[model samples]
Target: MSPFVIAITLSAAVLHAVWNAIVKTAVDRTTTLGLVAFGHVLPATVMVLLLPLPNAESFFYILLSTVVHFGYFFMLGKAYQHGDLSVVYPIARGIVPALVSLWALILLGEVLPAQAWIGIAVIALGIQLSSWKVLRSGVGKAALGFAVGTGFCISIYSVVDGIGVRLSGNTLSYWAWGAFLHIFIAGFIGLRKRATLAALPLRVWALGIAGGLVSMTAYGLVLYAKNFAPLGAVSALRETSVIFAALIGLVFLREGNWKRRLGAAVLMAMGVALIGTSA
Candidate 1:
């Protein structure tokens, strides 16, 4: 990856971690997620009106990505319900890059060099290391299962959106449409939890929507980076967000065991350097 692409991806990682921290702090994960979806749709709706439409060929990929994203969100909510941010977040983010790389190799025929593979492994190991205490103590089976499911959904959508944006010929247009499609999720969740949705204070709504915007921008950066780099490598670099999330949890949420998490972050940073150099 070029330095420019690496910078963008790393920035996205920070933003991604920030938004997830917001969601993790919310009282109702599903309702907060719905608001986040609304946050995505609100801006996306305006952009869609102003931007050119994506090509017809890209629609199928866009739809596929949207469907996969729904699954991802649902699984994420379930994971959060059963585990702490530090525990669920690492496992969920940790598994995605490897899965994405495997999918890219098998389906997209994109084979990465040895150094890139080593970087991915190191990053994955660091992610696991950050969660070692939680894993050793046993994050409830339910959380582990849902988080693993979330990882699979993330990989599916990453590959789908990578191809989708390239086919659209206009990165912003594809991003806008993808964001707008989250409205379906927002609507569904809103309808299902009308009482909860309606009862949320304005402050909570603001936080949720802000979280949505951050999440949208984060993914948008990744989609743009995908245009210039291999999907697997880009995905692995993006998983550095796990390290960011750990730091956010420690500093902001006042979570414990900072020494181990910091060490994990250092290892992850080294892996990120390796991947950037290899690129």
Candidate 2:
């Protein structure tokens, strides 16, 4: 991959961690998640109006992605309810690089160099190391299940959008449409929490929507990167967010085990360097 694509993917990783931190800190994860979808809807609605529609060939992938996202948001909220951001986030993100690589190989006929595969393995190891404490202390079974499920959802969408955007012939249009479909997500959540949403403070609303904006931008960057790079490489790069999430968990959220998490972050960074140079 070019340095430009690597830069944007890495940037997206940071933003992705920040938004997840926002959700972790929310008073109501479900409502906050709903508002995050709403945030995506607001900008996507405007962009769709201004931009040309993505190709019809890509529409099926877009719809599939939207369905997948519903599961993703639901599982993510449940996982956070059951566990810490540091633990849940890494486990949830850890499995995606290999999963996406396998999917890309089967569905997209994409292959990576040996070095890239090694980088992926190292990143996966780092993710486990980052969450090693959970092994000793024992994360909730519910959290473990939900986090793994969330990782599956993320991998599916990443590949789906990777294929969709390439077929769309326009990254922004694909992104806008993909995000706009979250209206269903936001609307569903809104109706379910109509009373709670009404009672929420403006500050909560602002934060949730802001998180959504950050989420949108982060995915947008990833989508753009996908257009130029192989799906596996892009995914491995994007999952560097797991490391960032670990740091955020330690510093901002006051989660424990600084030494292990920091060491894992370093390993993940090295994996990132390997992928960057090899790609």
lDDT top scorer: 2
Return the number of clashes found in candidate 2.
Answer: 1
Model 1: per-residue lDDT, tens digit, 1-279? 688998999899999999999999999999999999999999999999999999989999999999999999999999989877766777787777778878888988988778876877887787678767557887577888898898899999999999899899999999999999999999999999999978889999999999999999999999999999988878878878878888888888887777877677767766755665675
Q: Which pairs clash inside model 2?
A: 1-279
RMSD of each candidate relative to the true structure? 1.7, 1.5
Tens-place lDDT per residue, model 2, 94-184, is: 7788789889999989877788778778878887786675665775778878998999999999999999999999999999999999999
> Model 1: which ten-residue window has the lowest total lDDT?
270-279
Candidate 1 lands at a TM-score of 0.94
lDDT of 1 at 159: 96
Instruction: For model 1, state the Cα shift of residue 23 in Å.
Output: 0.1
lDDT of each: 0.87, 0.90
Each prediction's TM-score against the native? 0.94, 0.95
